[model samples]
Target: MAEPGRQEVVRRVRELLARYRDPAQVDGLGDDEPLAVLGIDSVTLITVAAELHQRWDVTIADDAVLDPEASVASLAAAAVAPGGAGDRPGGRLDVVGMGVVAPTGHGVPALWDGLLAERAHRLPMPYDAARGHRAGAVAGASAAEVVAPDRLLDLVCLAAGEALGGLDPGRRAGVTLVVGTTDTGGNALGHALAGAGDDQSALAGWVAERAAEKLGLGAAVTVGSASASGAVALGYARDLLLAGDAEEALVVGADTVSKSAFHGLAALRTLGVDGCQPFHEARRGIALSEAAAACLLRRPVPGDDAVLGRLAGYGASSFTTHMAAPESAGIELALRRALAAAALAPGDVSFVNAHGPGTKLGDVAEMRALADVFGDRVRTLPINSVKGLLWHCQGAAGVIESLACLLSLRHGTLTPTTAAEPVDPQWREFDIVTKPRELADARSAVSVSCGLGGVNTAVVWERA
Candidate 1:
């Protein structure tokens, strides 16, 4: 095979650019001028590189893709060059450390043990109208923990401490904190409403600021995308690292079960009476729980042995069709985009950590998306949901579930969907895991999360 003419390559590059930028702007660009001159952002540059690989079977180096000096001429030359791989849009982030506090237990090890052993602390909802509906509550945490600001902060600080323990104390100053929560300042508001605390702004980002202050980290940001908050925060932190805005990012997802959250889900008739049983025929609904999880992410350093897994790529989407129910198309789009960004095919995935919240509609929509994306592979592809084990931690669900993926990568075992019996026949196409399964040398896995308001997120992970 021969390289395309320089003129043709330039034309193709410009054509791809037109999809993300104004056609007029792309058309007016000079071949040899840097793409940055046209105000092309780093993300768009990576997207263009991925498109180039998809169209021409060639890949540019990630450095070249992000280079401010690189232009259409340079990109075309790289495309025509031989023997390079991986110029996916989001690149990858090394998950050097992780921590978690859930109903199962504290820290990653305990959480892993509990998940595999099917151990959870279930109790009745404290509220009167809850009608003895049980949830996977954190064992030592009180039912009113959500209304206690210090308690919630303790959860964040504890998880962050464990995640940051391996890093040198001097390096903490360079780390940025990105926290995800559905109820940011809801605790403070709850206290205030009860006349137990002074009036203060209950902003969504307040907890992030508090956590950063406590952890002695750099700047902080918060993401509150319902149940998908954690994955979104991880994605944002990855973007910051990819764009050279942060040396390291500490992503924390912490949420406690609160009265309002419980009543809201109850009002929606999405609360489980017994416990979470994702993908089961007798599944009721979500069993809301409390959890906090933290992950330390940074650019891969050569010869670094601390890495547990690699965040190869992530993608998110929001469908405006429903406020509560999810749309399969949006979920499918996020899944497809994640694989594309990671330069992975559906068949390359070994297993999946799903967002199965146990509700019939939610599970049905997610299964539909999976079947569409993976096709016949769904029949054999090992898939499992942690909701049955950890329950739904709302904003914290994404990170806790993603941590399950990292564990799977490190241990080469897929954790089971605890007590998920009588599997839903409608989803018989999917190989839902009920017992621990060996990974058999597979390296890549995906974690999919869907939240209220039709928000969906997917992340690809690789064993380090």
Candidate 2:
């Protein structure tokens, strides 16, 4: 089913808003007026959204529901609500190719080996002392070795090159590019401050532009929702394809170690000095890593060997709960929505690639969310976190871990989490795999990401 026209959407939104406001207030409400200023609460907005979803059968993101500036017209424009959660804006997008450059290794083969071997490649922290003694720096690569002024951009090009290599040149026409990063060229700005380069090009916009130019792709849209940036970018690209706005999408996620980023994490006390120990009783916090990962997505082609897997479903949600701490309700909503988007039941999910930043509160919140959504099925669900092995790659972590899901679909094995023993008693019902486990007949996986500003995202992938 197609989404309603802009006019219809606007009319429906305005009609709903009128029910909550006084007739005078409704009459005075301008299209640009802030809903909050007019005494509209979040619950009222959510109620309106629920009604709209029931009416239009389209998926409306929680971010829009909680947005402070949400007005009737803007909400209508953003919702485009076509089919409900059970309906995908577009059909499944095939992941034709993937590439990764991480602290564990570069390229898919090396990455798979390192992950299956459960290796934690840590290096002495080179940035801020407050970030701890060890960090996950990409092996054998420095800022000077890359052609781009920013190492982050260089990583993007490198990973994109690999993913694009498998794509036929004839199929590259009008390919949209989406880059995700929290510190988009922030390190470049640091160098510009030292008078080493043009300061203007060091801005976030230039990072996306330069990366798209370097990769011979279209003007890039960058997503920066902290750790959820990659997943959000993937979801955004999927929506574009579904909406017929683009024929193809090259989604890239990259982040490099920076003093500012380190200090921020340090301020939050989320740096793991010893190492990331997800779901463990003695878990400290995240071991920051620099990584770049890319995936090429397009409409599925019959008998295409290059097709790695299908992006079966994706969902995103944001809460006004807490800045750094995660809320289980938001996480569960995203997960349930993604499953609905995929048209899959909780029992169908083979395993989960969790965010698991190894923080005290963050890990517990995720577990509770998983338990909430999966219910008794949590006891058998093989949930694992790669952060203990590859460390948290920040903005790039989502796609990097997503690639792990594809690899699992391809290899029929579930990678283990490192040092996950002495499990947190709170989640004893959950199976946190610490050793490599064969997938057997499993054919699907879920990757969940939660970030600062109460951002949450989930993507479900099925073997293609």
Candidate 3:
């Protein structure tokens, strides 16, 4: 009663299930066993689809494969059908408002002003003068001023308050907050433990809940990792929008510099002696910084500040190639995939916000990748790294860098890559915009970030 190729399809499905499932949990899975019944979560299902595509060059429809009744037999049958197509149910998503707490300035307006003026916010550490770690710190009002002392929940609450600004209460209630960070309250708790020999700061989950409560939202989620956390949060928000799970999502990426992180980077010799000077021949390394970046995503509404841009496409890749080095292949794949998804060529991108950490090897590798991928286009497009102004905010850098891209799109201007007095020889082919350039018809831009553990992400945005 089965179609001609149904058996082969079923065989492939069985193989995938066997590979993905725990041998101890499921002794053997039958063709009719539902995927959920086999204990597969959404992320795992996505991974399964990716694997299947790579193996068979067949795409699985999320709607069909995600059904509760979806089974190996059903999926195989669908895959075998010649004309069946996967259903992609999400509608277009847009970015309406962005809130930033960065070293150059706080809030969107101040940040934009600083970027346009080409001012460097890099300075000596303001919090712990004893550490003597020069950093680009947020100006005016410490985190303590906005958040209560010795409380992680209070920090989230305060950040949410500052981010919400003037949003309507009804609208705010419908918006969900998605926080991204590697260590939410670890620094505060570490200090508390050292000072009093007791663990007292609220946990990360409580902080998320408190943030949701402060924002008058129904739910909150937290994403953790290194640089990819912010992009991952944005990707998740996009999925929520497409799935009709939420009308609006507030994505926040925040992280403060900690002694552990600072010391670790210092030990690795990646900390810059001077301020961060990305893509410059004289570049030393990165300057660790502290900041938070938040952006509001919602359906397009009329008269919304002409929307700097909408997040067009996102692509990510992770590699274990190097623990402390950058991978050109991974970076290239992520950028190429992102560009392909956006249906744009390298020439279509007017500017790039590079994840230049200012390390000699890292910057060279990134430049080589760009040259390999874009070739002649590399020389035509303007490129810069905001780390020179914002320092390296770890998990927060991705979102803050994205905000900078949005600002460039909105203001029709490109901020120069500061301290890049003399461009590196490896980047000779690329047009390194040293001073602010007027962005005439520059509607789209790309932001690229690579993290430790070999995580690479590229996000494309188009003027709305």
Candidate 4:
């Protein structure tokens, strides 16, 4: 078969681009203009390229699609090039690196060591709610100190730089940054503005840009979905790679405990006076913390060197449940969607990384969802949450927890949930992995995240 001419390519590309937006949004769009000028955002451009690859039986490098000077005509030409035909030649997407800043410590090793030891790093909170609340934090950074709005950028740079470490500058430019963050350093920025006046203000909210510069990357996208933000970012990264939008994608979930969170959680009475004891019969509420988690993902070339593990599947679901509570239906739907995406079943899952935050309602809902979706297997299948140990990292919860799953896949050891109170009698069927257990086959497990506003997400982790 012969390649389609430029005219045919242009027509199809235009038709596709138009589908993403109303005609008015691209009123002045030209075949020779950069797609961005026509209001086509990076995410939309990625979708367009993926569709082009799938529909036209062609493959185009991500940069070509993102090139500003290159017009629709040029992109069309590249798509129909003789070498462009066919699905991308690769195995599957894999998690290559991870970086984390949790209460346990910074970096992946610290995270693993702390988790294995089942250490709890609580912030020492002043009894005076106005002063602060919690036990102690890692590296001498109390939750109060770490949660300062200004510390968010510090966390992002620390984690992202680690994730991209040892990568030559050239490789960094080829990677796209997808940052999921709930803490945006707003209070810090506002204070700075008040001090310096408008003319002397710093760009406090340019987090993604600052992160890109710190990590030597070209661009970044910021995703926010409350506690599920990090997982949502991971979901986007998976699609970007599967669509050939980038050679690699870096996802960061970072959030600092802010004054607002403190006040709100305190008011809601969700702050556990002691450390978080998830799913305990005497469970209180969530213990909020400041943290950042990062993961680097790449599509695998056949016979590639190696990877930590493969992010086989991810799915998210939303339902109009109360903002402060979770509904089992949405949680189950998200889990089933992820399993189906991986072509696996509940029986195939080795274990579940639950979103158990210890809240009476949250834990109960998640447990019921697991029992309903996995059936009697819930009685024997291992399920646990890092929240018992890590505190509630909020937006970073998803990313850090998912990283735990990847670690288990690599080490063949299923980490245990910290020993909390006994299981709530109403939900005794679920097998909470309360003690460190070695997995006979840690090949596949699902990591879950329950967020405010009914946002729920799940990602499938598999052996590389």
324-390 in candidate 3: lDDT tens per residue? 7877766775676567556677888888888888888788777776776678778887888887777
List per-prediction Cα lDDT, in the order shown.
0.81, 0.80, 0.71, 0.76
Taking all chains together, each candidate's TM-score versus the true structure is: 0.80, 0.83, 0.76, 0.76
RMSD of each: 7.4, 5.7, 7.2, 10.6
Which candidate model has the greater TM-score, 1 or 2?
2
Query: What lDDT score is found at residue 390 in candidate 4?
Result: 88
Error of 3 at 431 (Å): 0.9
What local lDDT does model 1 show for residue 315?
Answer: 76
Off by over 4 Å in 4: 1-91, 126-132, 142-149, 193-205
True-structure lDDT of candidate 3: 0.71
Residue 260 miss distance in model 3 (angstroms): 1.8
lDDT of 2 by residue, 1-464 (tens): 13456667767777888887886787688877888888898867766765665456444556777788887666766664445434543469999779888877778888899899876455666665443456676767543333134677777887888888856665664678888888756667667777877654535556677777766676578888899999999999999988888888999888877667877888888777867789999888887788899998988778777778999999877753468888776787688778878888889999999988889989988998898888898989999989888888888999999999999888999999887888888877678998999987879999999889888999999998
- Tell me the lDDT of model 2 at 266: 82
What TM-score number comes out for model 3? 0.76
* Lowest lDDT 10-residue stretch of candidate 1: 79-88
Q: Which runs in model 1 stand beyond 4 Å of their true positions?
A: 1-87, 144-146, 199-203
At residue 197, candidate 1 shows an lDDT of: 77
Candidate 3 local Cα displacement, residue 22, angstroms: 32
Native-to-model Cα distance after best TM-score fit, residue 147 in candidate 4, in Å? 4.7
lDDT of prediction 4? 0.76
Tens-place lDDT per residue, model 4, 70-152, is 67777776664433332222235777778987877878998888888987566555333544457435545854565454477
The local distance difference test score of model 2 is: 0.80
Judging by TM-score, tell me the better candidate of 1 and 4: 1
Off by over 4 Å in 2: 1-40, 43-89, 129-131, 142-149, 199-202
